[model samples]
Each structure stands twice: as structure tokens, then as C-alpha cells.
Target: MHDWLDEEDDALITTALELMEEQRKEQNKTAARGQRAPGAGGPQYSG
Candidate 1:
């Protein structure tokens, strides 16, 4: 766990996580609009 993070560090980490979540949501929206995802695997693995 990140229990050792102080208040400032916690705030920074939370902000970074929120930004990442926003980016993920935006990417999902783009994919829903027919754009390929960042790492578009052509097909499922059969292994």
C-alpha cells in the first residue's frame, strides 16, 4: 500500500490518478466512436 505517502504526496497521487481516469474515459469515448484503441490486438489469443 501507499501508506507512507504524506499529505502532499497523497494529493499528487490522487490528482495523477484522476487525470489517468479522465484519459481512459476519453479513450473509451473515442473507441466508441469507431477509433481503434491504443493497443488494438488484431485477434484473441488461442494459446
Candidate 2:
């Protein structure tokens, strides 16, 4: 029973790690596209 529980926990951890990696990659892609226009309300400095 202990072994089974450990296996389940390992699987869940692995899945969570994979999902995080995917999200990171997606964010990098979006960032590479560059920031949105100031008028779009993305981010701007009002100097």
C-alpha cells in the first residue's frame, strides 16, 4: 500500500511539472512577440 501511494504521488508531481513547463514555454512565446501598444493598456511609462 505504501508503494502504491508513493507511485501515485510521483505521477502527480510529474504531471504538475510538465504543465508548468508548458506554461513557461507559452509565456516565452508571447513575450517574444513584444509588448502591446501603450494605447492598448499593456504597460507604459508616463514620463
Candidate 3:
């Protein structure tokens, strides 16, 4: 029914938001350390 669909949608939205928040936190940590995140490519040091 409609209620079940709404619940599924809400769960999907919540999961998406949580993933975004986690990614943001990881990016912040990477920035603070001046290192590239995994799968971001490139080297962390010049020599």
C-alpha cells in the first residue's frame, strides 16, 4: 500500500543522508591531513 511505499522511501532517504554525512566527514579528515582520499587518485607527497 501507500504507507509501505512511504516507509521505504523514508528509509532510502535516511540511508542516503547518512552516507552523505559520512562522506563529508571523511573529506574533512582528508583535507585536514592534506592527503588524498582513497580512489581520489594522485600522490600524497611530492618526493
TM-score against truth, every candidate: 0.59, 0.67, 0.67
The models' CA-based lDDT, in order, is 0.65, 0.67, 0.71
> Which of the two, 2 or 3, has more lDDT?
3
**Shift of residue 35 alpha carbon in model 1, Å:** 5.2
1-47 per-residue lDDT for model 1 (tens digits): 65756877989999999999998777556565543453463333222
Q: In model 2, where do residues sit more than 4 Å from their true spots?
A: 35-47
Q: On residues 7-36, what C-alpha lDDT tens digit does candidate 2 reach at each position?
A: 999999999999999987776555555455
Q: What total of clashing residue pairs does each candidate reach?
A: 0, 0, 0
List where candidate 1 sits over 4 angstroms from the true fold: 1-5, 35-47
User: Which lDDT tens digits does candidate 3 get at residues 1-47?
Assistant: 47999999999999999999998777566655665354453343332
For candidate 1, what is the TM-score?
0.59
Minimal lDDT window, size 10, model 2: 38-47
Assess candidate 3 and give its TM-score to the true structure.
0.67
Q: For model 1, give the 10-residue run with minimal summed lDDT.
A: 38-47
